[model samples]
Target: MTQVRVESPLATLSPELSAQKLLSRGQAVGGVVVIATVVLLLTLSATVGFGPSVLWYGQFAVAAVTVVYVAVIAFKLAMVFRADGSPVLRFEPDDLHAIPDQDLARYTILVPLYREASVLPYLVERLSALDYPADKVQILLLIEEDDTETRAALASMELATQFEVVLIPDSPPKTKPKACNVGLSRATGEFCVIYDAEDRPDADQLRKAVLAFRLLPDRVVCVQAELHYWNPWTNWLTRCFAAEYATNFSLSLRGLDRHRLAIPLGGTSNHFRTDALRELGGWDQYNVTEDADLGIRIARRGWDVRMMVSVTEEEANSRLGNWVRQRSRWIKGYIQTWLVHSRHPVRVWRELGTKRAVAMHLTLGFSTFTTLINPIFWALFVSYLITGPKYLEPLFPPLSLYAGLATMVLGNVMMCYCLMNGCMERGLHRAVRAMLTVPLYWGLMSVAAYKAVFQLLRPSKRHFWELTEHGLVSHEA
Candidate 1:
């Protein structure tokens, strides 16, 4: 008897096709649920002497807002997809070959560490292996003065002569941005980039960013590199997290650049002009998400931020607790930034001009607020399903319900489309399995958003750096 080999479920499905299928299925399922919920609510409302007018009017308002928001985003994405030439400063490795090598700009890389000893070895090795001239690159391992264990690990490594340790003076509110500000004060490079201790960036990322700077207009002050993950297959949490990163870095950011709006800077691999950064007072020590706050400041000051195609592969938060902590910090920072900027919206809009100011506020300002609102909306939906029209009676009418359902469906389709575009761009189409985790991811984000809001209100509460522990290491023992 002849035996046939069996293919695994994943092996049998074409990654590209699977990604498309997953996106389409999600949109369909979500649309159906939203529509059914609206219809059920409307029917119950009618029986309780509530007309459909309220639902229709409320949905009309929501639909109008959603249409405009999505249209702006879609147009921006199209522009990014159609753009020519590199978005970053590009210096060919061959061009460096002719520069007599001695006149090359000295580059400094700052990796701010706080209780990250486990991943320090890998980070150090990766930085040392970069394609740039080792002699010209100064790798500063910035550590908190009190993080003795991480300092000890760095001392143990027989590192190359190019690497040096910079100990930040101990201070209250020990956050990464504050540590980075201290490092910035000591940096002597013509240009600099920030990396996290857990990052495994591409060796040529620096070279590409330098080239981009040369090609961009004088107004361009910073180059943001695309961040991705190498081990998305390890678990569901990681896979979903990686997908979110890919979508934001690859599509959302590029789209932002297309519209000439402020692109919030990522936490790592962001190349900046030393003089310009210095003029801006470096990173904000008071803000939790200093990078994002800085981006808005740059844009308001008439400087441009561009995105480079170069990809940096880093680890995602594998543990749920770790993910929540990291996310909470980010959301908290967003709330802080939004409040700070909106404090003088009229002045800000006048400085940034109308379009960019509005864009910045909506993208960063409303993001956390929207996520926090999701839980309340979802709760109302479930209540309507269980007790009929009692919960939704105060919100809207029947016709408005249908309109709201349509808007929700359309918005979800757009979101999925944007995500699919990123996956297709990166050739990680198989990673779409992570799409199945969207509901859970949204729920977690809702929880984090609410927590962030609470923390933001209590300004006196000192928040600590919730470190994400890395589980995978490729460095040799």
Candidate 2:
């Protein structure tokens, strides 16, 4: 019901675009109650026989958690192979040019910023250089009203007529989605797309997107392009990042699109039909990772999101601290989105059906829960090494013990293999050696995941966006 119904011609004219609560009253209260119950149980266990309590808890939590994660990883393994075999559309620049000027749709590009003044020059340069028809494209530089520094920097530049600074009124939540909502309200285009300040997308990305929308059925409403870390050779962190992106954008996402599963749209380079976006109430202002939320929402509204082959080059967070902050925010938002949608589990399952509902959990739910509980599993591993499998014995009987052992060993190996295959497919040679040491990176992610869980539990900081600093590395795209 959120998206514009295909049968409803006046859907675009009637706007239900408004910023709403981050979570429903029922959902928020239910979450708080669940957390309180867990705390109380833990406290009670401290007074009770700790061994008995720990045995049952560890048995269910550790074994079940790892097994579920392995299943999800198995799905990803299939996606890696499926993506390799799938074909993508390729068009020469002349093909786009051949389409008459008036036939092309007017495109609106929205880039929301807080304190990104440093990258404004390069951003303008990259955006202005897009090969899309100049007259048909409008770029909205959505800036926060209170961010005087960025606004001043933007003012200093002599931007083209297409580039306009759309100042968003100061508001709570103050997330990128909030700024994006303001820009969306004033957007005048047949289609709209989002870009990060440091992104340098393929010049023909827009044309490719338009072609996708044209060729696909009415139900296909959004298209996400391939995202790549342009400066992957910058550092160890960036190299690992490149491998992750390769797996996610090139392999996993394409597989999702091919199978008609919910595609978690990347933050940038997600092209949407303007009408469909508005019908979904634009972006959830409170969701820090609104792109992912919107992708799921699009599927719920009886629409599908497709993937494009064009690459959108983005800057990698080279600094460990900066990378952790960004990763934590994303994990936090995934937690939020999952809670919001799964509030009515039956309704979600009924709406999306079995396959898609499962896809949602394995994607968003998998990332959030696995990262948060990974350290616990690691601790269990250490405990097993020192003592034995007494804690794990209950979950894995004599017959299943070997299988459980294989899961433990194969889980890490599979992930490393996925990273290597994805990296090699993308021609990122540096990541081959880097994958051998990627477990350390995963430990860092666990660090961020813990931070994300703590932040999510804090009601006051639920919407607090830990912005990642871009422009650290600039290389030839």
In candidate 1, what are the lDDT values of residues 256-374, reduced to their tens digit?
Answer: 77677788899999999888887776776666787898888888789999987777888877778888878988987776666656655677898789888877766775556567766
Predicted candidate 2 versus true structure: per-residue lDDT over 1-477, tens digit per residue: 011111111222212222134566676799799999867776777787544474456556555765777777777787777885555555666767656767999999998887999898888898999878788998988887789999788767788888877777675767898778777887899899999999989988888888778887888889888999888988899999999999999888878877888888899999999988887777877788888888888888789888777899899999999999999999888877787777778888988889999989988888567776778767867888898977556765554556556765887788899999889889997679999999889999999988987887787778899989987875454
Report lDDT (Cα) of residue 182, candidate 2. Answer: 76
Among all candidates shown, the one with the greatest TM-score: 2
Alpha-carbon deviation at 295 in model 2, angstroms: 0.4
> Residue 76 CA error for candidate 2 (Å)?
1.8
Among all windows of 10 consecutive residues in model 1, the one with the lowest summed lDDT is: 1-10
Give TM-scores for every candidate, taking all chains together and pairing residue i with residue i.
Answer: 0.81, 0.89
Q: In lDDT terms, which candidate is top? A: 2
